[model samples]
Every structure is written in C-alpha cells, then in structure tokens.
Target: MTSPGLPDLHRHLDGSLRPSTLARLAREAGIALPVQPRFTPGMGLDQALACFSLTLSVLKSPDAVRLVASQIAEDALAEGVTTLELRFAPQLHGGAPPAVIVDAALEGLAGRGGLILCGLYGEPPDLLSRLVAIAADRPGVVGLDLAGGPLPSHDFSMSDYEHPFAAAREAGLGCTVHAGEGRPPAEIRVAVELLGARRIGHGTTLLEDPEVVALLRHEEITVEACITSNWHVGAIADPMDHPAARWLDQGVRVTFCSDNTLLSATTAAREHELAAALPGMTPALWNRAVECGHQARFTRS
Candidate 1:
C-alpha cells in the first residue's frame, strides 16, 4: 500500500538520526558509531535506549542537530506526513543548552510541525523547570512530554514530575507521558490522573487492563501507537502483536506513528502498512485512525 498521509505524533528527534547523516556527522566530529543501531528483534528497552548514546555524539553540534531535524522533516513530508510532533530531551545532546538545540530543531522544522520537548523522568528538577520555561517561550513548541522508561518502581514514590507537570499545565502546554509501553497499565492511569498526560506514548500494556482502556476512553486520551518500534522497545514480541488496532476497536483514541524512523529503518508508510495488517484491519478503521491522529496532533495554535 502507499503512504497513508497520516500524521506521525510520536517520532523522536534522536531516534530519527539518519544512518547516512550519522556516519557523516560522526566522521566530521571524529566520533564512532556503535554497531549500526537498528532495532534487533527481542532487544530490551534498556538496550534500545543505549543506542541513543551513539546518536548523542552526532547531535553535539547545533548544525548537526539542525541537519537531523531538517532531514526528518523532509522525510516526513516526502512520505505524506503533513503533521509531526518530533520529540527529544534536549539535555541529552552533549551539554548544548536546551534552548539552543530546540531553536535549531525548530528552524529545521520551520513551517512543518510543532515540537514536543521531552523532559526525561528523574532529570534534575531545576533542568526540568528550565525546559518547561524554554518550551513555553519557543514559538513552535506545543507540548511538554514527560518521557523515560523502566516505569516507576512498584513502590512508586517518585514525585519528580509533579511540579513540572503543574507548571506545564499552568503555561498551557499539552502534556504527554511515556507510560504503559514497557510498564504496567496502572502507569497510564497515574499519568492521566497525576501527571496530566492527555496522550500516552506507547501504552502497549493498556490492552491487558480493561479498566485502563476504559479510563483512556473516559479521559479522551490519545495513544501514539508505533508498531515497528514496539518490537525494538520490547513492548511486543512482534509487530503483529501491537494493540493499536485493538485500541481503536475498543473506542480508545489512537494514531499510528513511526516511533523512530532512522533507528527502526521504517517510515510512516511502513507503519501504516503494519497497522493495516492487524486482525480487524479495514478501510473504515484505517480512516478513523488517520482522523484520530489529525485531531490529536499538537498544532501550535
């Protein structure tokens, strides 16, 4: 099938660093890549997360970062993705100020899509506050994403994101959280009830719990469902195992996304193709997913 012309709402800036560009940037910076980063099936989330260490080398310079953003935007445009929400934690880009990296990325995505700046969980509280302020000030920043992995421990006493989420809400920035992908379904409820997440990044585990699925429908939260990345991130054993189609059937709002184009060597077209192969795949369901994505996209309005 051809590209679905759907909006990709969960692509990550660091994850979209093209292999060719990575090689060029690494050669220019004298940094070496680690074993060609693609999602080897069965790779755990920790392993997948470690791949970004190599990408960080390429992202050290403003020009390199800008190049990545521009290339990703152009790639999305070519693949019929008109709306995008490229995300990345700015502090991870080798000590470059968050604002500068975000600015460069915004310039690359000029007139293309709005940015969703991420603040990784357990990040320094001061830096988190600074990122919220920066996101509030940046022209194309439409959301503040609380992104990180390993889910909260079972005891779940960390309050690191509370103040930041409150501040983001106060500033009128949309909130999305990385939860229920590698974590329990309860995390999704925590994100919505406590963290003010209107969208759940991944949320693969959500189908296992009907209550959470109902909560998702009740709260009107959107899920950024990335089929290929699920294999990479250890969220599912196979792309066929993705619950996006199921989520849609359950009346849960969902949109197909290429979680990491470069990292997964996949595209929005590829993601749509995967979604179309799901058990209940139908033209009507596909159209609904596309419309859900369009409505949920973070426009800098």
Candidate 2:
C-alpha cells in the first residue's frame, strides 16, 4: 500500500529550510555560508551542527527570522504535511528580544498557504520561565521544549530547572524536553520524573533500560525520533540501525522528525522513508507514528 501522508512533530523552523532557499537568502542578504553548500550532504553531526550555527549568524535579524519562518511553512505545505510543529530558540536573533522574534515568526506565517503550529525552544535552568511566558502570551505558540547541543556539558539537569519547568506546568503549557539523545538514561528519567515532560525528544538511550522503556510506554509519553540526526550524530551507527523501530515495536509512541533538516539534508517524508528501511516497520506502523505525533501535540486554549 502507498504510505500515508507524513506529519512532522519535531522540526526546528530555522533548520527546515531548503538548501536553495538558504543559498538565496544568503545571496540576497550578502551573507556568506559558513560551509560550502556541497559539504552539507555528507557532513557529520559536528560539521552539520556547525553549518546550522553558521546559518544562525545570518539569521540574526527579524527580517531574516520572518523569511525563514515563511519559507519553512511553504516547504511543509509542499511536502503535503497536514500538521507540523516547528521549534526554535526565540533568543537567537540578536538585537530583538525573544518576544519580538516570536512575533516576527507569527507574522511570517500569517499569509502562509498552509497551517503550521509553532513552538519555542528553551534551554533549562536559565530561560524556562521566559519560555513559558512566551507560550502563555502567544496564541500561536503551542508547547515548550529544551533544545541545545548534545553533550554532558550542554545537558540541562532537572535539579537545575525543576522550579521553572514547574512554572510552565502551572501556566498550563505542555512540556517536551530533549533527553537521551546523547546523554545517559538517567537524564531521560529526570525529564519525565522531575521536569514533567509529556514528550521526550530523541529518547534513543531509553532502550538501555527496560524499566525506563516500560515507564515511557506506561506513561504514554511520545518520543520524537530524528533518524537522520541520530545517524549524523553517531548516536546510532547507521540510520538503518536506529532503535526507533524497536521502540515502536515495544509499543512506545515514536514520532519521526527532521531535527535539523538543512544540516541533515532531509525532510519528514525522507525520515519515514528511511524508517521503512529498518526491520519490523511497515506502512501501518508509519501511520501509527503520525498518530503519535498528533496525540503528543500540546493542545490548550
């Protein structure tokens, strides 16, 4: 049977642009890409990450943010995506405050041809309350997330950010944290137990602990699995070996995403296609993944 349509639950708006779009933007603004475009296709995780950071250098203004956001929405529409949750750190734009960046993003989506739900990414321990306040203030903002580099030094421990995450919960904002991607299983546990995360972004390491896996299944927490990102990061030796299929087989809710589409040179459709190459995955299972995304989405008035 033909695969059902794809829905991207976890994508960074800044990371979802087509390479041609990035090149055009760079040219229009007289900004140079950090790495040559040719290097992006086969670049490793660190290199890909560097490329994304370079893109951010050019995206340091409100007009750039608006342009990227609009392009992301248009790209999603072209992909036949019915719904997509785009995440980004609002503070990435230099001069403007986080709120203004978010407002500019919303403005970018105003006349877009399709519906796209946007969420703001926050680093824990420092900006959780500010992130929550943005969600509370913006009707278009749907959820809260923790996104940053994947390293022990970059990890946001719950011990450091519990109170702020609690504040977000009190504000009725839905929570999702990037855990278990490159960190230990204990970090994943903290996200669920301490941070009260309803969804775990890149919870690949959870498979190491059956109890943790069971808890995730029992709690009905969704895992946003970015296949290409995992492969690029060396988290999994190969895209074909990623444990997303195993997690799904064990009844864990796993949704596919393009963590940094430009860096990874992929899309939600491409992710699902790669997933299908894994053992035990079928079109039916892929549809279930989409359902998991819809279920995991933060819905509040």
Candidate 3:
C-alpha cells in the first residue's frame, strides 16, 4: 500500500468510474455500452481511451457526475490516499452545463481535495478559454490540465493552448500538461515552455532527453508517473523500462499516480507496489517520490 499520507496528483475522475457504478448508471440512463468499460492487460492505449467514451455516455447528468466524483474520493480515502486531484473535461460531458458539472464534482469531492479541469488537445480555443474561466472562478478547482490521447487525432500545435494556459497561471491556477506519454520528447519541452506547465502528466519518455530532464529540474516541475496505466496503454513494454527511477536519480521530481484506476484496473495501493518494484527504485527514492506528490499538489489544505 502507499503511505497513508501520499497524494495522487494526476487521477482522471471521468475514467475512474467503478464497474458496478457504471453498469448501474448506464442501465438507469438507458445507455448501452458497446464494450465493457473496464481495462484488461494487453489492451492498447486507443482501446483504453475508448472505454472512457463509454463511461462518459452515462455521466450526462449532474447527479451522475456528483455520484461518481464523490465515490471516487471515498474510494481514494478508503485506500489511504490522504489527498487526490481528480481531473475531467467538463466540455466532454454533453448533458450538464460546464458550471453545473464543475459544481457537481466539487460537491462530490466534498473537500477531500479539488478538481483539475482539463482542456483537451483538439478542443477549440474559445472552449479552452471558458474552461480557464471556470478554473479561475472556482476555488474548488485547483488547476488546469491539458489532457486527451491518440496524438494523431489532435492537429493543433502546443502554442494553440498558450493563451488559455497563461490565463490559468494569471488566475493562480496550477498548470499541468499531458505530454511525452506517447509523443516525442520535444513536446514535453513545448508543454513547459509554451503552456507554462508546473507539472507534467504521464512523462513516460522523459529520460530520453537529458536536456528536457535538466529543464524539468531547473524549473522544479513535478512529473506525474502512472506505472500501471503506462503498461496498460503500451507506453512501456516492460515495467523495468519505466524512467521513474532514472528521473529520481537525475533530480527530476516524480509522483506516482493512478491515472485511471478502473480503466487501468489499478488502485493507489497497487500503483505504489508496482512503482516500488521498478528497477533502481530504492526505498529511499520511493519514499521521496511519495513526498514529491505532496509537494506538487495544487490543492493546498
């Protein structure tokens, strides 16, 4: 298990819905999921992402959103996670209004931590601006995140998100970007330089570029590492190849996280164990990694 004091800084609430809850919500909403919304080993990233679409279909109401968010917090607490930031894109939930969705999630968390509103890579600038506006106004919202997957579908450049991210920073909102999961290492630099990211989500390939690693250390940026999720998404073929240990040894801060608990079929306890087993990940470095999560948290209590 993770230390009871550890914080998961990079979870996606939308993708972490429990299987039983999903079935009940889908049944009540009269929505039929094409595939089971659970992750299995060996599934590619595309397939895992597709499961999120199925999860979103049933989360069309504020009540549904609230229930899922609240339960995720409860589960995290039950698993000994003292702090967690659950991220989700309000724009993707077609049923409820953005503010309503934000409120529902905040209500759900009930002060366990806070939400990190996401702006997807392919979304329009105006939409991103609106998301930033929501983050600015809501104290329950702790940060702004650049999330979404399958790089081929997103045609926009990193600079396209610069304005909204800058606005987020101006509003005192912490900024994080989902980069270097499957994209080239260069995009991670773009995320930091252009988007003003203070944290990086799924920086799986960060060790590939020494310069980028140095920049992360110089900038004091935290890297959110999701070990189980990386393997499920084929980001790393073998768990031993993960860069978490190397990053720590090289001075880049890393916080182990469960990116999508249900979608990755993992929990904080499981993630902690997996990270602890990685090559070169000593007990001291593992402990420091957990400490880094608390340091990197956007929601300061």
Candidate 4:
C-alpha cells in the first residue's frame, strides 16, 4: 500500500539502496563488508556505512552508476513517490567526472515518469568551477549542496568556493548547505550571510540561537529536517525532542526529508510517521509540514 503523502525532496541517491541490493552488489564485486553491528533492533549505522562505502568502491564505472540510479528510481516508484529530488556527492564516486556520474544517474531515472532533480554534494573547493560549469550545462541539475560530514578543520570561508555558490545563483541553480547538522548554528548563519544558501540542510541547531532562528524565518530559508538522520547521528537524543517540530511551530519554514535513507533505515513516509508520533504533533500539523516540503522543493522552478 502506498502512503498518501510521499514527496521526498531530500534523499541521497547513494544512501537509498535497499539492504538486499547492497548485499548483491557486494557479492558481485567480491567486496568484504564489515561485521554488522546491533545498535538498534534491526539496523546498524556501521554496517550501513560499510555497505555504502563498498558499493561506492565497486560502482566505479559508468555502467554501475546507471544500474544504481535505476535501482534508486525503481525503489522510489515502488514507494509511491511522485516527485523525488535525489542528491549525491559525485566526488565521492571515484574514477568518473561529476557530469558522467550525474548523466548516468539521470539515464537510470528515464521512464520513471516523476520529477527528478539532481544536486552536487560536498565542499570541493577545487571542483567549484567544474561543478558550476556542469550545472550550467545540465538542466536536470537544479541545485548545489554542501553535504557530508562536517569538515570542522577545513577552511570553509574561502572566497573561491563561495564564488560557485554565487555562480549557481547566477546560473539559476538553487543553493543549499548542510549546516547545523552536527555543527554550531553559527555555521548556518555563515551559509546564509557568507555563502548565500537558499536552503539549510539539517539546521537542527537553529533553535539554539534565537537570532539565527529569526534570521532564517525572515529570509524564509527552508530547513530540510531529517529527523531519523539527526537521531542516528546523535544530533538529537530522541525524535520526540527534536527541535525541528518546534521550529515549525514557531513559523520557521521547516520541511521533512530522508537525509540518508539507508544509513537511517528510513523513508520519507517513515519520517512523516515519526513526526506524527512526536509529542504534541497533530494530523493538521503533519500535513502542513509535508506541504511545506512541496513549496521548498529544489525542483520547483
């Protein structure tokens, strides 16, 4: 049965693989997966990351990219997703240029009959020019995102990288950053004031600073709220206590997302379910949250 509301706007293409698919790929490539951990009842972050790394390691060719992207689209279709904006850090997939990776992934989405928006992930300073150039060339590519684990020690304030953010704006590509996922709210501020981010990914820490919250609300910056992902990554201790719900209540434009479905063992529908189960959550509020996602979609032009 398909869920009524499943507009998955913030999913990682590499992170949406089914466990069985991952296993098949591992076996096919002769890659040894690390021992699965029992952190939760039926899921383990270590095992998931290991599988993802192995999959990326084996998926070094364009054919593998096509296969994986096709599988992702097929899975989304089965889940009743009418619109899916799949994000992936092409730089993570070695041995191919970003364009080749994106093109192969888009090829897989062919005949799916859904809106598919592509994005560039991570903070690759040197690849900024190439990324902007590619986005300029590809109409399917809608946005540029700074994702992955926080590079705390890396200098993110460089002007060269900021130029691409500006370039994306000029090129009509939506700009977003994975700020305040595990970092401080100041990072979120920099993403807006310094880098000109149109959307903030996992801005869970926004509630910590009232000024930052006000700024986000004032700017109408949409926060891509990934509840399960934040919980799994220790950004929040529990889904019930997640600040995203509070952000929504306070007029902050927050939208639900599945940041890394495979890693979090979640889907967009599951995210909605979790939000519904949260304390003080109501059906009306849940619907409003989902609607917010539709408006905040990167594919909305």
Q: What are the Cα lDDT values of the candidates?
A: 0.83, 0.73, 0.86, 0.70
Worst 10 residues of 1 by lDDT: 150-159
Clashing pairs in 4: none
**Candidate 3 local distance difference test against the native:** 0.86
Alpha-carbon RMSD to native, per candidate? 2.4, 3.3, 2.0, 3.6
**Per-candidate TM vs. native?**
0.94, 0.88, 0.95, 0.87
Better of 3 and 4 by TM-score: 3
lDDT of 3 by residue, 1-301 (tens): 6345778888898789888999899999998866667766557767877777888888988899999999999999887788799999988887878988999999999988779999887787678889988777688899998887536577676788889998888888899999998667888999999999999998888878889999999999999999888877788887667889989998899999998987877888778888899999999999899899888888522
Give one digit per residue, the lDDT tens place, for model 4 in 84-201.
6777766667768777877887687674522233233334575765676776777777787776544346554433357777777788777788788766899899889877887888
Clash counts for the predictions, in order? 0, 0, 0, 0
User: Relative to the unseen true structure, what is the C-alpha lDDT of residue 144 in candidate 1, on a scale of 0 to 100?
Assistant: 85
What 10-residue stretch in candidate 2 is worst by lDDT?
113-122
Model 1: residues with Cα > 4 Å off, grouped in runs = 1-4, 151-158
Steric clash count of candidate 2: 0
Q: Which 10 consecutive positions of candidate 3 have the poorest summed lDDT?
A: 148-157
Q: Residue 64 in candidate 1 has what lDDT? A: 82
| Model 2, residue 172: C-alpha shift (Å) | 2.2
Candidate 4 has a TM-score of 0.87
Q: Which stretches of candidate 2 lie over 4 Å from their true place?
A: 1-4, 37-48, 111-124, 150-156
